[model samples]
Target chain A: MSTRRLFERETFLAPLLLSPVAVYMVLMVGFPFAMAFVYSFSNVTVGNPDFHMTGFGNFTAVLGDPVFRKSLLNTFIFTFISIGLVLILSNMLSELLTRQFRAKWLIRFLIMMPWTAPIALGTIGYLWFLDSVFSPLDWLLRTWGLLGKPHALLGPMSNMYWLGQPGLAMASVILVHVWRLLPLATMIRIAGMNSIPREIIEAAQVDGAGYYRRLFHIVLPLLLPVISVTVLFSTLFTFTDMTVVWVLTKGGPPDHSTQVLASFAFLKGIQGGDLAQGAAISLFFFPVLAGVAAVVLRIAKKAVVT
Target chain B: MANVQLIGIKKHFGGVKAVDGIDLEIKDGEFLALLGPSGSGKTTLMRLVAGLEEPTGGRIVIDGADVNDLAPRERGIAMVFQSYALYPHKTVFGNISFPLSVEKMPKAEMQKKAEWAAGLLGIGHLLDRMPSQISGGERQRVAIARALVRKPKVLLMDEPLSNLDAKVRHTAREELKLFQREINVTTIYVTHDQAEAMGLGDRIAVMHDGTIRQIGTPEAIYHDPANTFVAGFVGIPPMNFLEREGVVIGFRPEALLPAEAVPAEESMRLRFIVERVEDLGSHRLVYGTIGGTKVIANLFFRTPIAEGEERDFAVSNRDLRRFDLRTGERVRP
Candidate 1:
């Protein structure tokens, strides 16, 4: 009888318990998405409070611009390269971290320091570190005879214009993004590694699997779903990210080489005062991101460990 | 086939001695069961033999070569874990073919070997199915197939049938013994179930407190246990140890008989006050007290005995075993 009463209370109170989170989602996420949808279809701007519906005009204008096209491509390249590097480096580091070692907490803290720092602050620090004239990187490279003068095997060296050149600036942004995402990915991979049964690893060893064989066959295959999740999260974060590129290069170095969709949207919408085109530009992220997420989630489901 | 020799092998985890110094030899193609209760270091000893754990002290010799420095892969051994440890992501075929692929065996040869092993284990029809899609018994067969596919010199099994239901476990045990016989691989099987060890092992090593108390054939271990531990461990209802003067008298439940069934001159007789009788289909268990010691008798009769009735129970002198009171070691009369 008490259990039945508890059940009745649970049934009665479940929705009441859930309503706050539901309402919060509606206010925080749903409302913004709906507003963005409406703004994408209308010519809304800061100057004019009243606006009329526009039929694909903003999209057409945004897509017609070569800079917008370049931004789209840059966003894809940056997200892919950064996530790829994060996956590889974090997998290696997570494997090492999972092993028994002394001073492990210190190593973990050092690796996590960049991720724990505010992005803008960390990127600003990178900006100074990669400064062309007075960069510590340049100083180290010069000391190693890889910059500032000709050396054996290495061609004549000079100060690398890290953010001054288009290619170098893009690489720099991707590197920083990889550095920022690595700690989280490594943590996730470590959890995945720990979740695997120790008996399975021992069985593999007794079955005569060498180090690489055990890793690729047993460990990697079992960790597929977790790896997919890490990739999906990092990809989403890097794809729409504007902070690192904004603080480091601000989509500059001429010809808009390092510009990505999010930065491009911000530049045109808020700074350039072309709010309609910017809303349309940012809306482009939706379908592509959704498609990628769908594909990855399907893979994750298929590879889920039983 | 290879003989395995352990020479003072020891493993210490920090300060805990998981496996202390031990020495034993396993003849080629022998099925030796490491029987012990939990935390008795039987599994740790098996792991040390498989090269899963490094020994802190002595050497493990396989086929006359010391394998102390060899990696598990280099040791040429295969193990089936208690959980079965089937690769969940892989199909039955893929799981069985894992070791072959590691060796870079030709695809056709690997397929044949895997299929042959699956056929041997009677899981040939389920080769394409994922491990999760199969039943517990089928997964057990798949684990066996995977281990046997490599045809390693030595096989280690850590309670392989422990995860199966009782009904499946019996059948799996029968199949495992038959499979081991056919393969003739030197096998070390670890189990806490004395029934499993007795049914399958050629010789059973009863381990306790990080050391082997006795190693012998099932009959030898049962009829002439080296110590009180073995006598207590090997039987189902367990041997009853009644405190006597300088020693403890041990006797099986089956050794007790009705007073009238035994001659008065040949057997020791005791007065028992019947407390309860348990009907177990083919047999009945009579629980009673003799003097101050509680004693149970296995009676193969359906006749219900009244509770609180005093009766005489007789145990043959030949069936009685004695153990030292202090050391728990067996004492010959």
Candidate 2:
């Protein structure tokens, strides 16, 4: 009876030990999601400040807003370009550095520095480099005759607003996101490359596979999980990120031209006096990111089996 | 099948020599095993022959043609890795067909060859299954099938049966031997298991510290081991080693028996205090000590030797393998 009690005590203590983490998750993650869901149904504007229930009104208001529609389109455009570039460039660089050579650690360290740098600081640096006048980039380009004269890249050049024009603004944001995200993707890909058994590669070599044959048939297929996870994370970050846009354009020269969902939400609730709509706009990003994550997770799982 | 020759092959990893100066002549259609413990350079030697690794020095000739600059595929050889190295994402059919596909054989011909190899390995029924779905022995068969489908001049297998269960490894060993005989390809196999090496190799090259200690038939390697290492390494429970006054004496456990059974001139009586006795169904193993040296002797059936019992043991001169105590080499006549 005492032995049975001892066994019961041991098993009972397992869940008891886990209760702290479970409580923390419920309070932090579950409560916020519940609050967000509740806020989605309220007509809680910032100035009026009344948390009165309003069934789906804020969502319908967002769907009707031109600003919200533009933000949605810009987010998709930024994510598509940035994630695509990150996947391709990171995979290529990782494959190159996977080979044994002199100074490999040094090369890896240099490449990974961008990822280790603070994002706010990196974006600030980008802002300085792309400054319209007295920019080193502009000076170098003008000296090479690539551009007409010493001018800020943010200015209107041939009816194109690099920071305000819809297409160019999206492109600027996408390029910055890719630059910042490349190091992470490259590191993950390198890790994936390292995990592949040496015997497998040797087997392929002994089987008569040349470099390209080995890369395409063996390496790429094995690296799919890393690639998928990287693409998923970058997609989420690029779609919702406002740091680079905020630092460079402040969401725009002409009122909110570069506003993505995140910056738009900030503008609406804090500056424009619509808390309920802002909450709804912030929540708009959830489904899209969740869907992409789900698909990538499925792909990653399938890749692990191979 | 083609004969292979390695002339002064060497490889160094930083400051360490993995395959120190070594040469081997492998004849056509012969099954040879590179037998050694881990880090003894057997696998490294096999890789050099397969062209999976570049030799730091020397030349490799296959079928009278120098293949030093040739890649593995170009050398007309195939290797089965210790891990099986099957494409886990590929089906059994696809795994076997990889070499043929790599060679750019016609699709129909590749399929035919894969099917033939699968049939030969008795795995035709599992052609559509992935490598993960199969047992270790089945995966081993698939790896062998992949190598066979290539129709290479030589086959290199590195510790192929080490991953399987004991019974499975035993069964696979026989099947591997049968397949090698039927194919009659010049094969170089590497293994740490001396039993597998003895059972499979037509000629076994025993290696130590990146060099070949001896190369001979299995019976010769066992009965007349070149040095102390082979004598101690070749048998189950290994040969019992004893040293006295610069003379290293060794003999198999079965060779030692009760003194009354043998003629007095052919045997020497030694006294030992029993430490333990174990009954292992078909035989018994006695653990004891003689003149401060521990000794193990096997008996045909369960015997009446008890713990702490003292007894007279006789070892025949013909069965003893004597080596120099100082040098650890065979005391050659």
Candidate 3:
């Protein structure tokens, strides 16, 4: 009787069940954020190991560097382009994946390979693919007379120098990011597509709406909410991620052409021994992301089934 | 308006046959109800006609044209799903105008036609409301309005009213009947409810296990069933049967009456033992055994017999139906 009464206490059981998550949040998330906040406001470095309050110093130092500015610009360019491609490719893929096909399991598994495999492993694999001289992609272009040979397809050029060139390196980084993020977005979209009733789609077919008409008018409108969520998550992951850029380019050629805010911050704080500046640079995206998050939330709410 | 013909239509899902060898001809502007229990291929047959599913064999011809290769849009058809399937994101006006927009109709003309369709359904006042903002009944009208906006060759509906409350369904049924008459469009309505079929169908096709058992007017189907399945499926508490002499004798519960109440010149009498009675307000259901065969007698008038009593009951000669015991086919008298 005593144990039954104890178990019946809603007030006690609810908090008890939630304690582990609460503990994890405080220790894992809250503590790190608090430390970063303090470090951003103070002058702390790996060399000195001292906390001296110097408000705006780290922020000013980061803002003044041309490399920091270039990285800030690069981050936006990479994220937006990658997200744009991810949206288009993933939407088309989700549409195709939702329909019946032969060996669909293999296609889905292959599409998900980029995401399921370790990020470092995938990026390392890309290194061989984008190698300046030995890349099979360059070899294919050469065989097609597009990379080298006089008066070829893209004007005579030896090796194509994929990672060696500024423009090509940035493009390569964005493509890698798109490839990494696409499967997750496609899966989310497929789930959204499935949630719509089959009868509703059939109703559209009978109502004289053809394939394109149904896609634009009916399917896309209903999937708007889920798509917004997918875009938001992918945006956050891409904006704050350094893995792909780090492994493939490492902000190479000393020009910081493919440098993003996250990679730049890692370079400064963890590698360059300027812990204070790195924390400040890392926190730079907080306000921008927060603004984006607010807009997406509003859009998602409106897209919800009324 | 157009006529639809299904010539030996069959649909097989792997090893399972959802519809098998169904050949039905729907007259121009006629409302035909495909009636059957669930998994009886009524909906599958309807889908085949709508060009939603391609049959494993046979052809579907609408308005005298074979629509084997035609898409649903090219065939000119519309459907109201059981859920009413309104675009939750679009307002009623947007939904009604969607099909017209597909044709790239002039915006002004599209708006006018949509308003006209909405007016036909008396949903003109709800033009601006989103589907999620409307009631279930209103959403159904919007779905119908959308279907009608295009003025398609045929209209197909799958249990459109089964989602409504009982009180709402009655009025909606009345409205739907009136709307169908006013439009005079060829329609195929699929439903499992016999009452809905009887209320709406110009002719009802009763189906079972993938093949149609019978197709006729409500009066004909109720009065003359082709087989035991139709006889057993068409009515509530169904037709009671007693097997005797390699023949199955079936009669409606209402036909089984007290000996004195059945004033027919020739009647079959049975020694009935009362088990229990259910007072259904409008009628009493007499649950009892007749010649050791469990039977139900629907009596409009109260009887004096109580539980544990044995009495004489009779079925009028005209009301008795006989079927072959082995085949369950009605044996011609």
Candidate 4:
């Protein structure tokens, strides 16, 4: 066959193969995103399809609302704290798992159970575990004399309102998010650690690096890119997550103090019947997430070991 | 500089004996090469000395101190791995200075030491570059520099030159020998290549089946191998063994010559039917069968020999090594 014919065949085949994916994306993700963008600028509401472009009026309203502003702040706090905890805790877990031990597979399996179980189910489980009256944590604390007058720093002697208090509720959400994301980060770290040549670690040992030295100087430096990617993924996962908050508090505690962007958007857009404002509030996620993803990816690129 | 002594060292992986009982005292400032084929346990022995592997039964002594319970770092040894093991993320300067940095050495002093070591290895210009940015030879130099920066009493190199190309290996080997002489460190080199061991080692230890088969000066190991295994393993075109009654006669190809070219009182003569002749530039290898036993003889390319021709070859009596066929141990005269 002529070279030109072969080239023509390849070019034609490329688009033909890609067309299904392109069509699927347009129908599923692309259409909804485009509709959301249009709706965010229009005065559209439930059962009122007829509307005219409001030109940032919905954006102005959403941004001006105190609850929307609070939700935005909460989203950042939730994502940052949860991801920070995930990064530190998962690194420790991965390092521990990588060492030689007995029953390692079983330990790893148990650690991964939180991630593998359905998030909704796991959140519900946590809800019961932290229940106001019959909480295991409160029981343990009370039994240990960590509650009441003598141990004032540990909180009241009575059953602490876990999901009912603003601070405790936020901490609970962040903790659950960290627990759910730890397995993936730890697994990623393990893979990164394993990819390092055994000789490099042995060389470090021979060069007089102790365990901590090897960890800080050799393993952690090599894992920088992997860690960055893990943080990025966990941040994205925690930022957009509403199920945990919705299931536990539904952005409650009287003042919407623990309300995050996703839950607030759900309450305002879907439940409150103001689709335009909801789309505008949800649209706030795009630029912040994009900025975060860009920064993380750049850091990951710079930290590439090889 | 310090001597390293391994007494009754034994390492076993489940049922497999990686390094069986071994006892050797490496002299201070002496270069020793542990030479063997793959699975010969040379690397295992090196790791035992470096404190990288724990011996099942042994005492490792460095500089008159028992270091069996010490970690590799505490043992004060540095190694140049077969893969070079240059930290991929670190610059050459960072890699070379790692040992010092681990000790929290002052920045200026660490820089000076690293630079000096880099200069010694002729890699000073590459210090700012990452290991990935350097050539294989440069990486090897960086690894060596890293090992040298700490000024360890003993240096361990595990096939440090095996990763380089052939031409580069030749120059690196010479430079390495010169560097070792200048530093005067007690060095243990591990390699499977006989040429590398012979060229670099003050004394070469030949290992087989997780045991030291022979240990001697390179000259002694070459001229008077302690056993059949060393005799066979230490030479290129390895020594040919021919069974004669209860004894096995071993002789190198280079030891054999055309009968006419040898004086009568100097060598023993054997006749064989030539099967093939391989002309290798300055010399030729003649393959033949003697009494139904195959043998090869290295001859000058100009020598008059042809395939299918019956020829007489001579080997000096002293050149022929005798061993018990069943035991495969050398018989001393």
Q: Write down the C-alpha DockQ for each prediction.
A: 0.72, 0.51, 0.67, 0.74
lDDT (10s digit) by residue, model 1, range B1-333? 799999998988998888888899999999999999999999999999989899999999999999999999888888889999888888899899988988899999999999999999899999999998999999988998898898888899999989999999998899889989988999999999998999999999999888999999999999889899999888978887788778999889888888888888878888878999888888898888888788888888765577888988888888889999999998986
- Stretches off by above 4 angstroms in model 4 are A1-12, A47-50, A140-158, B265-267
Please state the interface RMSD for every predicted structure, separated by commas: 1.1, 1.5, 1.6, 1.2
Off by over 4 Å in 2: A1-70, A96-105, A140-171, A211-216, A251-259, A265-283, A301-306, B240-251, B256-325
Ranking by TM-score: 4, 3, 1, 2
lDDT of 2 by residue, B108-129 (tens): 9998999999999999999999
Order of the predicted models by DockQ, top scorer first: 4, 1, 3, 2
Error of 2 at A145 (Å): 6.7
Candidate 2 clash pair list: A132-A151, A132-A152
Clash totals for all candidate models: 0, 2, 0, 1
Writing each residue's lDDT as its tens digit, candidate 4 over B239-292 gives 878887688998889888888777889677888789999999999998888889
Q: Give the DockQ of candidate 1.
A: 0.72
* Candidate 3 docking classification: medium
Q: Write the per-residue lDDT of candidate 3 for residues B1-333, one digit (tens) a residue.
A: 899999999999999999999889999999999999999999999888888999999999999999989988899888888998888888899999988988999999999999999999999999999888889888889999999999988999999999999999999998999889999999999999999999999999999999999999998898888889999999988898998778999999999988998874789888889899888888888899887899988888555657787888999999999999989999997
| DockQ pick, better of 2 and 3 | 3
Ranked by TM-score, the better of candidates 3 and 4 is: 4
- Give the TM-scores of the predictions, in the order they appear: 0.91, 0.83, 0.92, 0.94
Worst 10 residues of 1 chain B by lDDT: B299-308
